[model samples]
Target: MKNDRRPAGHVVAIASGGLDSTTLAYWLKADGAAQLTLLGVDYGQRHSVELSYLEATAKTLDATYIRLDLSGAAALLAGSALTDARVPVPPGHYTDVSMRATVVANRNPLLLDLAVAHAVSTGADAVAFGAHAGDHTIYPDCRPVFVEAYRRMITVANEGFIAAGFQVLAPFIAMTKAEIVRLGTLLDVPFANTWSCYQGGRRHCGRCGTCTERKEAFALAKVFDPTGYETDGG
Candidate 1:
């Protein structure tokens, strides 16, 4: 029996350089799991710095990396704290209501469509993303239902253009951040190389919603975090 059940083919992954996406990159490339491409979309988020991490991960994994500048879209989606300087990045857990300030309108669908386009052009069999269970409550786009509907929509829209047996994978869909952290640890992923701050500080702000979630994920996973934080999170 084959040890890994993952299909063998070219795959394009939507990479954000955060822990979840970084770990997904590692998982996708390890042991020659697939022909991997890391696609980063910068929609003028406060932390464009995260793309730098993705660049480094691509180098380490020898995976092709492409960054699309979608900053123009941010002008219209500027109400989100990620895209607008006027809005403050909420500090707290992801489940907090205020964290909705981080949601960029139509963010996932736009990104996913771009990935699907690239996959069709390149004949890649899959387009994968990192949308863990913890994100389900925070972002409707990250929910399993959205993923399923997206797959169906693309299958119908692309019809015969996409690769045979094309797939949309969200491998961590059922997992919480802590669960992903554990899997990353087992995969020997260098967690420190990943970024999770909504702020583009030299180090993690340690108070933003994503930073708080990152801190909690490591603690819950019993993994030693190597990230530097500007504050003690007090």
Candidate 2:
């Protein structure tokens, strides 16, 4: 199938050091992104360990890695479980109602804004993010409508610059986490080096929504997960 919207040339990827984003980075490179830059945001989330994995993934991919410190944003967007210590990170499946606490208000937009600015400054043709179908239920920003609307907004916001070929890409927007896992496997992504738990512990807290999702994705993909969790969610 010919993709009319195929991405090419310089690309900036918003990476969170998780399975989806890490996979997205590798996929972009394999799909012929001439130059790739991985952008990680430090918004004072509990799982700062993900930043470490972000750097490692960039090294593995031989892409430039940049970290933007948005810790101040955490204070402003404080009610979410990820940034607020008072609100606990919930356990169990991602579909659970309690998992909504993990949503950081306007996170995708804020991150995408930063990424787009970086892309514009650096002469990038596209900006990519790893948001997937699994995130739609919990994160409003991860849905297809939001992505398309944001793309249109960016296009209009850029005006004449749109002719320069600035595109907002979310390749996995319609894909499930398991599908991403399968694709990542095909791309030989180093899943062991990735991090996804909401808790910033030494090891993954398998009970957390992300960790559980990760485990489930690998299982569903029939891939052997190398992640070492503090406890077995199974």
Which one wins on lDDT?
Answer: 1
Q: Which stretches of candidate 2 lie over 4 Å from their true place?
A: 1-4, 232-234
Q: Residue-wise lDDT of candidate 1 within 1-234, one digit each (tens)?
A: 021234688889999999999999988887355689999999989899999999999999989999999888879897899999999999877655787898888888999999999999998988888988887777899998898899899999999898777888888888989999999999899999999999888899998888999999999999999999988663
Name the weakest run of 10 consecutive residues (lDDT summed) in model 1. 1-10
What's model 1's overall lDDT? 0.88
**Cα lDDT listed for each candidate:** 0.88, 0.88
* Candidate 2 residue-wise lDDT, 152-218, digit = tens: 8998887766437567889998899999999999999989999999989999988888888899999
**Estimated TM-score for each candidate:** 0.94, 0.95
User: Residue-pair clashes per candidate, as listed?
Assistant: 0, 0
Residue 96 CA displacement from its true place in model 2, Å: 4.3
- Model 1, TM vs. native: 0.94
- Candidate 1: misplaced stretches above 4 Å? 1-6
